[model samples]
Target: MRSIAKPATQHTITANAKVVDQLPFQDRQAYADARQGFIGTIDPLVITDDSGRVVWDLEQYAFLQDESPTTVNPSLWRISQLHMAHGLFKVTDRIHQIRGFDISNMTVIEGESGYIIVDPLTSVECARAAIELVYDHLGERPIRAIIYTHSHADHFGGVKALIDEDDIHPGGVRVVAPSGFMEHTVSENVYAGNAMYRRAQYMYGQNLSVDPTGMVSTGLGIALSQGQISLIEPTDLISDSGQELVLDGVRIEFQFTPDSEAPAEMHFYIPEMRALCMAENVSHHMHNLYTPRGAQIRDAAAWSRYIDEAMRRYGHKSDVMFICHQWPVWGTDSIRDFLTEQRDLYRYIHDETLRLAAHGHTMVEIAEMIEFPEGLATTWTARGYYGSLNHNAKAVYQRYLGFFDGNPANLHPHPPVESARRYVDFMGGAEVILAKARRSFDDGDYRWVAQVVNHVVFADPDNTSARELQADALEQLGYQAESAPWRNFYLTGAQDLREGVRTDEATLGTSDVLSAMTTDMLFDYLAIRLNGPKASGRNFTVLVHVTDTGETRLAELIHGVLICTPVDGHADADTSVRLDKPTLTGLALGAATLTDAVSAGAVDLSGDDELVYDLFTLFDTFSRSFDIVTP
Candidate 1:
């Protein structure tokens, strides 16, 4: 039968029951920790934008209070329940945190004069609401400084909401971050933003129905805040470890952990407050060695070492350890134990994956073979709620040995659709394969059923029977997934199979993100959008002069690539466009057309106006809601 979502099969129910049996579900430490310092929260904990659009609504997850259902993983259900603890909470007498407002936590440290804000949530509205909660309860204090703990958007995107742009100057509230923050931030969030943002929908399950049968939690937090994401460049950069900064009588010692969780990240210790902020390095569950949304493979070994260093440096002295996600860990002993388990979690994954690979194990085989030690396995914090061991083991393999597994047969294989067609033909056609897959599905082998039936569906997407069966298999897999993203991917795949891709949620207005881009950065992003085949054998040169910034750039599209260079002047330029940076950014971001800008006196074109317009035509607009489950 065709269905939107199916109930968990007996196999799935039994799988979830095994999870409850294996783990220490009776331990209430996480629950107690989540609610330790709860001051007050707006009942329903809803944050809306100025237009009344709901950005974050914790009330939707009111279903979490019920006992774990057969359709949901008990471990994931446990984390999702803990995440419902919303509002401003007192971490210590001098420290406070706004939790469950967004996917990430925003901490407020009371300085001698004002307040120090660390890692404001992902959206401006959510960050603003979080701070307002602090103001409402703790009384308003001047924001003395803003500290960004990492390069992730959730940590720094809401800077503009907390402090004014005019207040970013010297002798004003200082903004601090690790070195290479802007470079990584723009490259990850802008250059490859279209693809990353698209994958993020599936990873975060932003469009999934909220219930036991769909998205429950992100494994890290309840949900991502749907408000506008904004960023302000940091004034002060933390370059080296052991770096110290005293802002408004608060001393922060930084440990720069480059190429760990993020391309640019750090962990810092507040000596006076006795608080150590681990950033996103060590969280409640297993962190991603390779995030599904796509990025460079993170170094697992380096990730473990960073945790070890932080524990040695600050674990003893710290009264409380706060992370960018989930609740904080209190007491020196508890904090030390938490850090040790987390440290070993990454280390074991790294070491064992390599050890198995050395013994001639393929990436897929290594993923299946590696098992965590009992100590790391049983710990609630080490479990894979976000990043699973199966994917991470393969990630480490990819990082070291590359995608090739030394099998010449896999050196170059047919693409998905072609491969599926051949596989179906070899297996005696679609109906025959469906018969076998149904038996496997009935026998509770959903993973194998999903894999085999996928060939039939891809070979012929119009086959209703194949699509329905595949959807059923995926639903069963989703019901049994311990990792939130895994469940989202499986269910969302089933969703795509049933309902087709929803294209309306594809575009996000990135005007604020574009405004923060430097002239060079903007050109770099423009280059990424340049369709090589479209630009092939067509050459052009455009010289852009920003009237306000006095920055000039020469963009040459030749040999199927776009090359940009900073130039003071280019007399031989094919076209020279004089416009303000905002006007140029607006044109680049497709917010304003060249014809409109030129007519409105926003742009002045000296030569080859048609050529400039043609240059834009070579750029391709990316679809944010591309089909993933299908070709």
Candidate 2:
């Protein structure tokens, strides 16, 4: 499934309150020193069953088992401490939650008969740990229902770990979600699954060994649980504007927001508790207009409108308002104020940027021109930790219209590698650029050094000194960022430039998401990486025959454009490649070469052999660094 949210790997992370207090690194210090700065006040971390017997905890021998210690960067070490501080908190008289497990909190609602779960954490191991925590605190209770607040993975990815179908029994526990939740849930991650997963490694700091000065607060919170992922389809769906329902005796007032932060999302109000559950729609820091990992641009205007609507409808009444991330607010005034600032943050960025661009300014100029008024920026909640005003402003311009300013001269831009080389050639040469960059670096002007050295490296990628300096500049920037995501992006880039990005790791998605991917989305996903322009007006047509479905389709390349159409049940073409789904997946991942498949006869081809080369030609690649910031 497309993971709409970040990794949600909070299970293994720990955010240090004061990095200085942590001890010096020893062997296996990454996991050993996890409980460094701020951990829970309790004597021991343990969750027991009803009988007070031990159940789940910071796994039994976690420190001993974990060998890698990512302690060099203190910020990442600090963030990792947050996960180490996690525990199951009491929400109400009977309800409980395993907090700090993921960005999305898993609520355990106690029904008269059993338990009703809402939004299990991201991974199976973490969810299982959470369930044991609940049983230990509240006495054992059967699971009666599972409610997914939205389509995001953190909400549902751990279903299997929590409860199985056999546990639901004759009167199956109900599984509820917003309308089209299944479609949104599965499609979000898979279509562009490969590239998104790759970028997510940086966005989530997946491969980076955690430590202070490295990866910290994942823009959303601490890192997510690195446990098994699983999913289950919802049996009930909420589709209206205001829908009220009773599940397991608790009354839930759902504000159906189909296309807000997610394509399928909703928020709920608990009347008896006077609590408003604002899903990911409203968060601790300014939200993204566009996330670093790829996805359609979220509507800032629509997001603000929904928050305002939440304020008007439920604000004055909420005694304690809690969200998917961060700590909950208890006072009504405080709740209302937080909602207002978050809503206005999005609105301000949207309106002021368009206001400036109406006169004249390029995307970069608009980004530099617009800043949150001093009042908004000073407020802790509205700071550009996750979504900076600079980038979000540009996203707004990109959203409502195209990149061009109605000027023909600026419409087409040269490709990056080509332009970078020309730029270096015109500006003396790589050696000259490095010398000037070295001076800037020595002066502690990291931003300028990054700009100058990046040009040299992008122009001539082999220059080791340029790469080292740029990486050094990026590492310092990472240390200073208040936002966790920015820290991750900067540090990940630095780590890559220093040691180079690691081998592309494969992500095994949950079955629910994998099953929902449409055939069209599969091909379109591949097209994103197809090396286009290289094909350069080349013409090609080939037939792909499906083994499982007995379906036939023809792919046509005309004028460097690729098109797929379902032809005569079994389209006749120059090539009729034969392969099963597993082999096809292997082909996509490059586990086996085309020739290997051909030799093995796993793939049968006919007509012209050169057509395979033409088909592979249309792929376009993506870059980890494409100049998000200035030169």
User: Which residue pairs of candidate 1 clash?
Assistant: none
TM-score of 2: 0.78
Q: TM-score of every model? A: 0.97, 0.78
Clashes of each: 0, 41
lDDT of 1 by residue, 1-631 (tens): 2336778889999999999999999899889999999998887688899999999898889999999999999998999999999888989879999999999999999999899999989999999988888899999989999998888888987877899788888788999999998888776767777778878888898778999999999998998888888888888999999999999898899999999999999999998778899999999999899998888899999999999999999999999999999899999999999999999999999899999999999999999998998888788898899999999999999999999999999999999999999999999999999999999999999999999999998899989889888999999998999999998888888888888777854343545656877888778767887899999998878888899998888889899999988887664688889999888777666567778998999999888888988988888877778777777
Model 2: per-residue Cα lDDT over 489-548, one tens digit each = 777877777665566444433255664455555455555556566766777678877677
Best by lDDT: 1
Overall local distance difference test of candidate 1 = 0.89
